[model samples]
Target: MIDWKRNFLMVALSQFLSIMGFAFAMPFAPYYIQQLGITEPTELKKWVALFTAAAALTLAVASPIWGALGDRYGRRIMLLRANFGGMLVLSLMGLVPDVKTLVILRLVQGALTGTTTAAQTFVSVQSPHNRSGVVLGTLSAAVFSGSMSGAFVGGLVAEWLGYRAAFMCSGVLLLAAGLLVLLGTREEFVRPVEENGSSMEDRARMFWDKIGPATPILALISIMGFVLLFDSAWMPLLVQEINGGIKGAAFWTGSLQAAGGIAGFLAGPIIGRIADRISPPRIGKISAFGAGLMMTVVGLSQGFWQLFAGRFGAVFCAGGLDPVFQIWLTKTTPAQSRGFVFGWAVTARALGWMAAPMASGTVAWMFGLRAVFFISSALFFLLIPIITLIARYLQPAPQPSAPIHAGRR
Candidate 1:
């Protein structure tokens, strides 16, 4: 049997470092752009949006292609590619002289790097299906913890040194993550044989034919996009409303956003254990309901305490949903196709991430920010029915299956 525990720890550590690197630099993009001579407020906002949209679009386009390549080659190599690509792109970003150059680099960064998703592919393929919930959950915790820590560190570095300096530091952190994965982890990846000289189109069709049956999974991924969208677009406005006339509003807003990450970190393992006991689908359904309830509370809050409590509870509950989805996907997908399937899964979720915030932000702009919360609450409640559909497609995890062996590209 493979030493899954050791491999899991190594990948988890790498994920933390990779995410930390990302949060450190990416959060300071607007500040960095300001230094590049775009001083008008409207122009700054337009440039920021353009930069963000550019990265998201490229990432969504590239993720599945990388995944298919990983299935053919090795996930380990793909992980390395993402890390090294990030390190190079982020480091060079500090050297660029203009906003256009920075935007181009950002586009390449998105196309080349998706460390978390690639790392998940590494872990999911190597892990036993029975233990996937706990494993993926722990991984999720690492991600949240790293992101929270990164934001704090990034803020400090940006204040003390400079945004450019922070970018260099971010590159160094990703270098560490890459070294950890390259030196410490092991994979037994085995490439599927191409029998009967199958054409590329035939193989591509075969891949989707297998994935096309899981409509519920796709829906859930889409819901998560909205979840992220609501959290990103409305949380700061919610904090501002709660802290009317308060000093250090910015600090409070940061803390409020960080609270969700903290809650996710603490909740991941606990939720994973619970899912392992009953079923992932059951846990997912309950979590969606809980998140919806908390969203309603947030919509109705009149004070900081109520809003804080609602945000914390909602994030804690919703944190479990990703692991549950991974568990179901792991049980249902074949070992050889997991890299590609997860690639498609990541791409699907990225589409949500890319689109949801824009849609919700427009709503908040037209109506009130509170309306965004109410709409998000309804979306989560709608997820309950979708969660129920997942159980229909799931099968028992392959408990005693052998690990995938390392194969040539």
Candidate 2:
């Protein structure tokens, strides 16, 4: 067997650097929108939602195809494609002259990049069974740490140098990370052979057939996408509201974004350890409910401290979901089809992201921003029942090498 630890370190470092670059400019979207000259508060809000939705929508369409290709060719190639493609598009975003141009580029960006998900696929496939939980949690921590650093630095950069300069710097960092991945990573991919007369549809059916017992797990994964949409669309706006000003808004927003990362960074592995000891579905159920309750607290907050406290708890709980999902998915999936499963699962998440900003923005416009939080909180509460169903139904069938078990007793 290959030394999964070596592969983990290489991909983890690549993810850290690449996401730091992406987050550097990403958290300043509202400020960037203002720079493009639609200065009305409503217009700014809508544009923020639009830009986020544009990329997510494209990602929803593209991630599965990339995953399918990754399953056939190699995940390393997918990582390279995402990193290089992101470097090009993100850098060009710095030069766009208008909101329209910027939005167009963001659309292309969705299709071209998703380094985190790709990295997840790489690490998941490489990890040993017993260590998958710790490995995935560590990767999540690296992601949060990089994002935290980027948000903090990007805020300073946006304030000192300018948003365009921040974008350029982000592109440069992404390029460096891509080079590291190219030079350091090694894979022993064995290409899948096509049966002489089988069509794409037949092959796909065969793939699903191999993992038929894990279907409910796939459903649970899709629901996770929608759960995130509520937060993604509104979290920045929430920070700006909590901070109560335009002056130094970027810094405050970045600080809050960093806070979320800090929670994820600290809580992810701890929760992963817990999941390994107890049950991942149990962790999933409690975390989902806890996250929802915290979102409600955030909405109800009337001051900075209240918002801060609520956001931290919410993100802390939310951090558990991905690692648990990853560990569970890894356990349930056949080794050969891991990439395909992860890719399609990511596509489900992209769809939720695509719908979330649009829905959150429209809901905020129609009902109120606070209403968005309440609705999101309700969604999490709603998820508890679904998770219970998943816990009961999503049992893995007996594998020759690994024993099959349900997520709960």
Error of 1 at 162 (Å): 4.1
lDDT by residue (1-409, candidate 2, tens digit) is: 6677888898889888998999899888777878889788788878888898899888888988998899899999999999999999999999989998999999999999989888988878887778778888888988888888888899999888889999998899899889988998898999987555278888777866655656677677777877876766677677777678656878877777788889989977788777678789889889998999899998998887788788888888888887888788888887777777777777777787887788788888898778899988998888889988878776556668766588746
TM-score, every prediction = 0.83, 0.92
Q: Model 1, 1-409: lDDT tens per residue?
A: 5687888899899988998888776766766787798866456545665666666678888988998999988999999999999999999998899999999998899899999888888888888887777888899899878776776677667766777988998899899999999999887767789544278888767756768755567667766765655545446446656777323444454455467768889878888777778777788889889988998898999987888788888888888888777777776678787777888887777777767656665666577668888888888888887677556645546689677778833
For each of the candidates, give the backbone clash count: 6, 0
- Each prediction's Cα lDDT score? 0.78, 0.84
Candidate 1 global lDDT: 0.78
Error of 2 at 333 (Å): 1.0
Off by over 4 Å in 2: 196-201, 210-214, 396-409
Best by lDDT: 2
**Poorly placed runs, candidate 1 (over 4 Å):** 28-49, 93-102, 196-205, 233-254, 296-307, 368-370, 389-409
**Would you give me the overall lDDT of model 2?**
0.84
